[model samples]
Target: MKPVSILFVCMGNICRSPLAEGIFTHITETAQQQHRFHVDSAGTGGWHAGNPPDPRSMEIAARHGIDISGQRARQVNTDDFERFDLILCMDEDNLARLSQSCPPDLQHKLHLFSQYAHGTTQSVPDPYYGGADGFLTVYNMLFTGCKSMLEKMGADDVAS
Candidate 1:
């Protein structure tokens, strides 16, 4: 089967989106299903593009035994719609923005990040304005969402 590709999007790639990328990548790799999927992240805005994920984000990932240090901030490219099988937005506003920017052929690929998350419609709050605790909360939320995503990708149901 062809690999499923996913792109996580947020307002800024520094915090939430990178966390989702790292967490989901870690889960897929650990499950030995890394070949089944491709994961990446981007921001709706160009702010922080080309910068490494925020220090708090890296530190939190480290604490959880995942490495996010390699992730750099990037803007959601027009090509991303063609590249990713799913373009998941971190919240409603960004979802709308992605919807507006995406071409007609790719519009079906855009989705809310929380749709993969079990029983939660909450946005992964932008932690850039808050303290370390906020990063931790974002981490936990992404962890849950990533896990759910992995399960749906056949990691949980597929036998090795």
Candidate 2:
């Protein structure tokens, strides 16, 4: 089967999206299903372009044995709408931003990352302003979402 390409998006590539990307990548690798997909992350805005993920993000991932410090921030672009099989946003605002910029016909590929979370939150709250505890909370949330996403995206990809 051809690998599915997935892009994780957020207001800034510094926090939630990168965490999701790292978590998803780690989950796939641990499952020995890394060959089944291509994963990346981007921001709706380019303010942090060319920069690495937030220090908090790197710290939290380090605690979990996932290395995400190498990933750099980039803004979502028109080409991404066509390149990725799926574009998942970290929250409602991120989804809205992607929806507006995404081409009309290809808008179907856009989605909320939290949909796979199965939690009380319909969105992954940004932890950029918080401390270590906030990062931990977001980490747990992404972990659950990423794990469920892998199971849902079997050989056939996303289900209806």
Candidate 3:
């Protein structure tokens, strides 16, 4: 089977989305299923393009043994819709923004990342301004969500 390509998106790509990317990447690698996936992250806006994930995001990820420091911000574009099997937005607003530009044929690929995140809220709250503790909270949520997303991909047998 072809590898699944997944894109994580948020408003700025500094905190939530990148953290999701890192958590998902860590999950796949930990399960030795990384070869079955292609992971990347971007934002709805380009204001933080080319910038690394927020420092607090980095700190929180490092605490969990996942490093997001290497992720640079970028804006979501039409190419993403075509390239990813799943283009998951961190929140409804970003999902709506992506919906406007995503090609009609590929619109089915867009989803709220938290949809796979059972027990968590329907959206992954952005933690950019909430403070350091917020990063920790967001991290746990994304960790659970990413694990669920992996299971949803039929990798449940190996997702533990």
Candidate 4:
């Protein structure tokens, strides 16, 4: 089967999005199901384009044994609509913004990251303003959502 491609998107890509990418990739790899999917991240805004994820985010991820240090910020591209099996936005504004950039045929691929978390369809709160604890909080939520996403992919069984 072809690998499913997932793109995580946020406003800046310095914190939430890259963290999701790293965490999800780790989950897939550790489960020995890396071949099932490809993961990447981008931002809705271009202000931090080409910049690496923030230092604080790196530190927090490092504590969790997942490193997001290698991720660089970039704006979501037109081609991502075609390339990704899922383009998951961190919040509603980014979701709306991505929707405008997405073509009609590809619109169905866009989703809020929290949607896979059982009942919640709310936004993943931006952790840029608070201290490290906020990033950790966001990390746990993303981990939950990503784990759920992997389960939905039937990847849990594919590895066994």
Candidate 5:
């Protein structure tokens, strides 16, 4: 079977989304199920395109043993709607931006990254201007959200 393809999106791609991609990749790799998934990230806008994730994001990910240093920022494209099995945006604004451009037939694949989080907040806040602590908080949220997303996809069997 083809591996499930997931794309994480945010406004700048240098913060939240890249962190989510790294965290999700780490979880799958740790579970020895990396082969079952393909993960990537992008932003709703191209302002940060070609840049690596924000330094703060890389720092927090490093603390968790995940490196996001190699990931570069890109903007969401029409192709992404068809390329990924699931497209998860970090906040409602990003989701709304996607909703506007996504083809109707592919709308089903678009979702809030927090939908599977099982947390009180349904959106992942941007931490670009904040301190290290904000990155840490976003990391924890993505950790929980990624795990829950896998479970919902019935990929929890491999999450062990």
Candidate 6:
């Protein structure tokens, strides 16, 4: 089967989304299912384009043994709607923005990242203006979402 493609999105791509991409990538790699997925991230806006993730985000990921420093910020584009099998946004704003811009036929591919999370949160909060602790909280949430997502997709059982 062709690899499943996923794109994680947030407001600036410097906080939540990049971490999501990194955490998800790390999880898939650990499960030995890297070949079955293609992962990336983008922002809804271009303000931080070409910048690396926020230092707080990178620091938190490093604590978790995941390196997200190499990921650069980029804005979501029309092509992203076509390129990814799933486009998961961080919060309601992102969901609405993507929904408005997404082609009707492709709308099904857009979703909130928290939808796969077993917890009650319906969205992932942005941690750009928050403290280092916020980044850690977001990381844990993304890890849960990514892990549940892989299992829901039936790709979590690959031999490590």
C-alpha lDDT (0 to 100) for residue 12 of candidate 3: 95
Model 1 stretches with alpha carbons more than 4 Å out:
157-160
lDDT tens digits by residue: candidate 6, 111-144 = 8888745645478888888898788889888888
Candidate 1 per-residue C-alpha lDDT over 1-160 given as tens digits, one digit per residue, 9 for 90 to 100? 8899999999988899999999988888788888998889999999799999999999999998999898889999899999999998899889999999899978999888987666567787888989999999999888988888777766864322
lDDT of 4 by residue, 40-152 (tens): 99999999999999888888889878888878999998989999999999998999999997999899999988975445777999999999889889988988888888888
- Model 5: per-residue Cα lDDT over 1-160, one tens digit each: 8999999999999999999999989888877778889999999999999999998999899988999999999999999999999998899999999999999999999888887457444789898888888888898899988888776666655443
Q: How far does residue 90 in candidate 6 sit from its true spot (Å)?
A: 0.6
Stretch of 10 with least lDDT, candidate 5: 151-160
Superior candidate under TM-score, 2 versus 5: 5
Residue 36, candidate 4: how far off, in angstroms?
0.7
**Candidate 4 clashing pairs?**
none
Which 10-residue window in model 6 sums to the lowest lDDT?
A: 151-160
Q: Model 4: what TM-score?
A: 0.94
Native-referenced Cα lDDT, model 5: 0.89
Could you give the C-alpha RMSD of every candidate to the true structure, in order shown? 2.3, 3.6, 1.6, 2.0, 1.7, 1.9
**Residue range with the least summed lDDT across 10 consecutive positions in model 4:** 151-160
Instruction: Compute each candidate's TM-score over C-alphas.
Output: 0.93, 0.93, 0.94, 0.94, 0.94, 0.94
User: What is residue 112's positional error in candidate 5, in angstroms?
Assistant: 0.6
Rank by lDDT, descending?
6, 5, 4, 1, 2, 3
Q: List candidate 4 segments past 4 Å from native.
A: 157-160
Candidate 2, poorest ten consecutive residues by summed lDDT: 151-160
For all candidates, the clash counts are 0, 0, 0, 0, 0, 0
lDDT of each: 0.88, 0.87, 0.87, 0.88, 0.89, 0.89
Better of 1 and 6 by lDDT: 6
